[model samples]
Each structure stands twice: as C-alpha cells, then as structure tokens.
Target: QVCPGVTPPTGAVKVTPGHSPQDLALARAHGLPLLSVIADDGTLRPPGGGWLQ
Candidate 1:
C-alpha cells in the first residue's frame, strides 16, 4: 500500500474491523478505487478484482 506507492512492493496484513474505518467513510475516502459491498446476511465483502467469465 503506502510502501508500493513509493518503494518496492510489499505484502499487506489484514487489519481488524476495530482498526478499520466505518464502511461509509472508507468508501468516500478511496472513492472509485475502493468499494464496499454488503451481503443480504449483513456480511461485508470488500471489492475484489473480479470479472464476468
């Protein structure tokens, strides 16, 4: 993330929900690049690099 933008690529560690910003603010901050998807069961699925096959 912050590393790749400036230096060599690095792995990202998943942070806990308590550490993450609320869905709305996160979406607004990242805009189109980052998205939030909610499931019918109230599950949150962050954007994935998926396409129709």
Candidate 2:
C-alpha cells in the first residue's frame, strides 16, 4: 500500500482485475479513478462495447 504523503514512481500503472461496468460506474460516481481490464483469448483488453454489453 502507498503511504500518505508519498508518491509512487513515474509511469506507474495500477490495474484492477475482473472489473465490470456496474463496478466502474460506482467507482466513477464516487470520484475514484478506475480502468477496467478484461481477459480475452489469452490477452487483456480495456473497456469497450463488448465489455459493457
């Protein structure tokens, strides 16, 4: 966990596994920065029409 008054290194990327639209919406509503990452055909994908559907 990141400590208060401390900053992570540059170009740091944080990911949340198994994220869904409802989860994304709720996170956004609460002003949380979240990006959906999904697994497809042995690869990872970002949020899209198929993800939302």
List per-prediction Cα lDDT, in the order shown: 0.48, 0.55
- Every model's Cα RMSD, please? 7.2, 8.4
TM-score of each: 0.21, 0.30
> Residues 1-53, candidate 2, lDDT per residue (tens digit)?
55555465355434342356676666667677655454656455655445554
Residue 26 of model 1 has an lDDT of 59
- Write out the backbone clash pairs for model 1: none
Candidate 2: stretches off by over 4 Å: 1-18, 35-53
lDDT of 1 at 29: 62
Model 2 TM-score, all chains together: 0.30
Which pairs in model 2 have colliding backbones?
none
True lDDT of residue 24, candidate 2: 64
